[model samples]
Target: MNNNQNIAETAISCSGISKNYKKVEAVKDVSFEVSRGEIFGLIGPDGAGKTSLFRILTTLILADNGTATVNGFDVVKDYKKIRECVGYMPGRFSLYQDLTVEENLEFFATVFNTTIEENYELIKDIYVQIEPFKTRRAGKLSGGMKQKLALSCALIHKPTVLFLDEPTTGVDPVSRKEFWGMLKNLKKQGITILVSTPYMDEASLCDRIGLIQNGEFLKIDTPDNIISQFAENLWAAKSENMHTLLGDLRANEHIKSSFAFGDSIHITIAENYEVEKLIEELKQKGHKKISIKPIKPGIEDCFMELSQSA
Candidate 1:
C-alpha cells in the first residue's frame, strides 16, 4: 500500500533511538510504536528521557542514533512535514507569555496555515473552558487555566499525533482529572495522543504505558497486563510508629523488599514465609497496633521490582 495507508496503521514509530548529553545518556536504544488514535503513555519520572524522546519524535532535536517516524514520515528527512502534522506541548509552558490566550491560539493556527474557524470544533470543548479569559495574558493565568490554554494552542492546528510532555505536573488534582477527560474526547475524534507524566495513578488512564527509568524502559504493556506480571506475594504493613516500621521490616531476613506507600509500607517476603510469624516478630519489637496483610501490586510496585531486577 501507499504511505497514507501505512500512516493509517501507525501514528508513530521509533527504532534503536539513542541520545546523549556529553557524559550522560538521555535515551538508550528505545523502540516503540503508537497505534493511530490511541492514548499511549510514557510513564516515568523527570529525566527519564521522556522529554528527549519527545523532542526527537517532534523533530525539534535530532537523535544521535537510530531513526524515528511520525505519521510515516522520517523524522530527519521529513522534519518539515512532521512538524506541520504533529502538535507538541513541552514540559514547560512554551507559549507566548506576553500574548493573550486568544492571540496565542490564533497564532498557532496561522503557523499551521489554518484558521481557528476551520478547526474550532476540534478544540471547542477545551477552548470554551478558557474562552472567558481570552483577553488575559497567558503568563497571568492560573495553573489549570494555563494547562487548558496550552492544550488549546496545541490542538488549534488539528495535528494527527499530539505529544504532551508532563502536561499535568503542577496542575491541581481536579484539573489533572479534567485534562485526561479532554484527552479521552480527543481520542474519539481520531487524534493519536502520546503523553508523558510522572504520576503513577495516571498510568491506568492510558490505553498502554511504558515504565521508564534512568533513560530506559523497564516494561511496556497495558496497565492491567503489567500488574498481572507481578507474581510476587505482596503485602501491606503498618504500625503505630510508621517511621520505624520500614527499618524493622527491611531488617528482617524474611522480608525480601519493602517500600513505603501512602499510609503504609508494601513488602514482599521470602517464599513460604508465614505472615503470623512476621506479625509476632513486629509485636515483640514494640510495634503497636501493627497491621500486616496481603495486598495486590500496583504500577509503583511493579516498577520497583523491575528496577531491582534490571
Candidate 2:
C-alpha cells in the first residue's frame, strides 16, 4: 500500500462553499478536497477569491453558506480545533515588525502554548538560514528574510495542515526557489500544505493545482494534465512592431483570442485556421521582421483558454 494512502484521507474538504459582500461574490459554489501530505496550489491572480477561500479555511472569517473541514474538524463548528491543528501564513506580513527575528518565533510559540524547543526540528532548516539575523527587527529584514521568519513562526507549532497564501508574492527569484524547496521538505514529514500563488511559473511546482478566477475554479489537475487538456492551436507571433501587431491580431476575424506575452504575442486561432495565412495577414499589414510559429501551451495559455471558454 502507498504510504500516503495509509495515512489520513482528505486533509481538507469543502462543499458548495460560498461567500458574498453585498453585490460582489467572492467565492461561489467552490468544492475541493486536498489529500493528506499533498501540496495543493490555489493558482490565480490577486482578487481571485484565493484570500477569501483561505480566510474561510483558517477560521479568520466565516462563509455565508456551505461547509468546510480541516483535518476532519469543521471550520465553523470546530474552529478551535482547526486553529490548533493548522498553521496559517497569510499573504500580508502579519508578524510583529518591531520584534526581532527570534522574538517573533517565541511569541507565536507561546501563543500556541508551546515552546520553540518543542518543534525546533520542524523549522530547523528554515530557522538556521535566518538565525544570524536573530536580533534584527522583522521590519528591517529584506522581503525574502521577512517571509522566512513568517514561515518559521507558522511552523513552530508543528501543525498538521499548513495554509500559505502567496508566501512568495514580493520575494526574489532565488528566495522563491528556496521557499518552494522548503515546502518540498515539509511535505516529507507528512504535513498537508495548501498554498496560493499568482505566479504561473510556481504552478508547476505543486503536486496539483486549482485554477481560480472571478470567484470560480476554472480547472483542477496536475500542471501537465491542465496543459495537456488545452484544446487550442496556440501560436507565438512577434514582430518589430509588437504593439501594432497585437492590435492587428486581435482585430483579425480568425483569431479567438490574442494577448501580449513578454517579447511576443500568444494567439489562439478560430478552429481549422492555418498559421501560414495568419502570418501572411500580418505581412500584408506592413509588419516587418514578423515571426510566427506553432507553440506548446504553458499553464498561462491553458488558463487563458479556460477563462475565455468559461
Give the runs in model 2 whose Cα sits over 4 Å from its true position. Answer: 1-7
> Which candidate number maximizes TM-score?
1
Clashes in model 1: which pairs?
Answer: none
Task: Score residue 239 of candidate 2 by CA lDDT.
Answer: 95
Model 2 reaches what TM-score against the true structure? 0.94
RMSD of each: 1.9, 2.3
Kindly list the per-residue Cα lDDT of model 2 for residues 12-117, writing each as its tens digit. Answer: 9999999999999999999999998899999999878999999999998999999999888899999998898899999999899999999999999999999999
Q: What's the lDDT for residue 214 in model 2?
A: 91
lDDT of 1 by residue, 19-133 (tens): 9999999999999999998899999888899999999999989999999999989999999989988999999998999999999999999998999999999999999999999
Q: What are the lDDT scores of the predictions, listed in order?
A: 0.92, 0.92
Instruction: State the lDDT at 232 in candidate 2.
Output: 78
